[model samples]
Target: MLQIIQRKRMNLTLPRNLHDSLLKHAVFLSVCLPETVRDTFLVDPAVILIVVGVVMFFITFCGCIGALRENIRLLKTVKFSFNTLLFAFLSLMLPQTRSALEKFARKAIVHYRDDLDLQNLMDYIQKEFKCCGWNSYTDWSWNLYFNCTRENPSTERCAVPYSCCTPVPGETVINTMCGFGVQTQKYLDANKSIYPVGCADRAVMWIETHLLLVGALTLGLALPQVRKPRHTCRVCMGGRTSRRHQKGLTACWRSRAPTE
Candidate 1:
């Protein structure tokens, strides 16, 4: 506290008129931008999460109310909005741009190798699909660890991943060394040694194969809704018949009453 007082005492001061002018300007700013007083606070991770949580809560709350009330118009609006967003996402991910996907795959492997989840996903894709690299095993040449050159001088040079290897029966563990020097070899030898194609071609094939499945699922979802009105129409007709019969019985009893 004593040191703080000494530091303040040593602080330089402007002329009295200049000090007065600066003070007036500060007061003017405070009055003009009163709402920004707390805006100086840094937005940290916790604050970001809280904001996201609140936004999601509001959206979900509105959806729940719409569902319980059976508001078709509101539900349709929400459905259309969500579908539009999904369509946009699918448009971007579609296999139309083969070159773009190939480029993205090359960068994804190199930059995201340290990211465990992405790395695991790539590993699974390679193993499950029995493929390697973006366009071919040579695509690994762009990777620092796998590039076949003296400047880089890596142990993994001219090597594909173990996922590209053909599994030997009765082997509990993978032959990690099976892919070594396979990239530098000819395709005739490499065909027996490793997967010969690129991931982009395989991915395109997978998407093409599953398109009919996606269409079937979509058709299945829509058919139930289309058929729902048929069931409701029968119920509505039954209700009308019952109402008509009730009216006829009351009229018949009134007419049969003797001149009362």
Candidate 2:
């Protein structure tokens, strides 16, 4: 009888302990899994770029097909849509949109580890521009791992990424730890270790210095869209055009027409 009682207690205690252990592990995974997921998908610009590429290819393909088929309705739709996008892109230079762009830059820094491509791009920008974070070196604090908060558990807390570090003169190998604990120092002191300037200001200065080149590129891209549709429209209305007009339009479209 005593043996039976002992066996029953042993069975109950062992199962209870196993269940508690599994419950503890479940709670730990629940906390840690979301953070991994959040870090990965929080702000992936590559995905956005992929989506935009697919959309632009679809639009441009439709435009080319419409022009070839002499489909007036489809041609008009493409022209209108293209113009809308062009104007919208130009409007990004406006103050409100520029501010929004700056906000995006900050967010990009916050999620710097989310995408490898973005991380590499940011490192290149920082190294080439002699800049640090988006608005300032301190902007790295926006990243959870780099945050200086007392509650943060990251080993990288209070440190900047290696890309922000100033290169050593004539060093053959890169020093990954050069930026360690940089955020704990004063600006004057940290400036010795990392670039003090912000990438946003450097980018703006670059654009301003190359304003003419920027304008020329914009016009170059826009002119083709603007002129191609006019040629297509004239070709579609060939019956109304004089022989000279028809010949000129045909030559223009033939010269610049999109190939399949």
Candidate 3:
């Protein structure tokens, strides 16, 4: 589980038959009858360990090839510093960019159940910020499980995710039902159980308040990217200069008169 958490993305090319075999094995593991092995195969510890092993092997092979070939692009880390800064700046300063972020946040909430990773990320964000959905707690209505429509069959209908709930002191175990039926309540009533402010507003306000820190971090990341190419050029020029000096000395030595 820890190994899988560390891997951001994975793609490996293999023979079609080998790939199909692995896929079939993975499917079998996912549906195994043992309660311990059932359904959660994607995050199973053994599966994660195997994935980590394969990833390590692939990376080691690539590193060896890059080193042998002296491929600067492959040896050095890929720099996205400028693009990252630009996107961050635009998201902070432009209304349209901010709107897009808000919409994305809301969409994540709407499809919260579709991806476990997304659900975990959303939970973390909400818990950290002490905020609810994108616009309001009611924004969760867009999720099928939490839909407020009369026809929705989910037991959690009209409820926000439990991440929105205010923590109660001395509670040993989390009440997963803490946010139950929150969307159905009046604003004042719901506020008692969960955060009232939207996550988008909280995030924006945080950025505004920490503008100096953000700027410092942006500059810190950008400085290395700006300097790296210049440093590489200097090294190459130094090598050329050394070679020219050595050649001049060699020519002078050969041309010098020798006494018998």
TM-score of each: 0.58, 0.68, 0.54
Ranking by TM-score: 2, 1, 3
> lDDT of candidate 3?
0.73
What tens-digit string does per-residue lDDT give for candidate 2 at 26-133? Answer: 764455334444545545667778888997887888799897786888788888888888888787556477687677666677667777877887788898888998
> lDDT of each structure?
0.68, 0.77, 0.73
Q: In candidate 2, list every pair of residues with a backbone clash.
A: none
**What stretches of model 1 exceed 4 Å from their correct place?**
1-62, 69-80, 86-100, 229-260
Select the stronger candidate by TM-score from 2 and 3: 2
- Each candidate's clash count: 0, 0, 0
Off by over 4 Å in 2: 1-42, 90-93, 217-260
Candidates 2 and 3 compared by lDDT, better number: 2
Cα shift from native, residue 111, model 3 (Å): 1.8
User: What is candidate 3's lDDT per residue for 1-260, written digit by digit as tens?
Assistant: 87775563343446789887778656543543233323244433355578878856666666677676756665552224334546867777575776767656756765577567768878998999999998788988767678787756468889988899999999999999999999989999999999978888898799899999989999999988865654555455455446765576455445542546
Model 1, 1-260: lDDT tens digits are 99988888768657789887778657643543332213222222244468869856755766787786867776776777677757866787565567666655765555333345555666788888888888887777665566665544457778877777878889998888898998789888888978888888898899899999999999999989875654545444455446665565456545544585
- Candidate with best TM-score: 2
After the best TM-score superposition of candidate 1, give how far the Cα of residue 142 lies from its true spot, in angstroms.
2.1
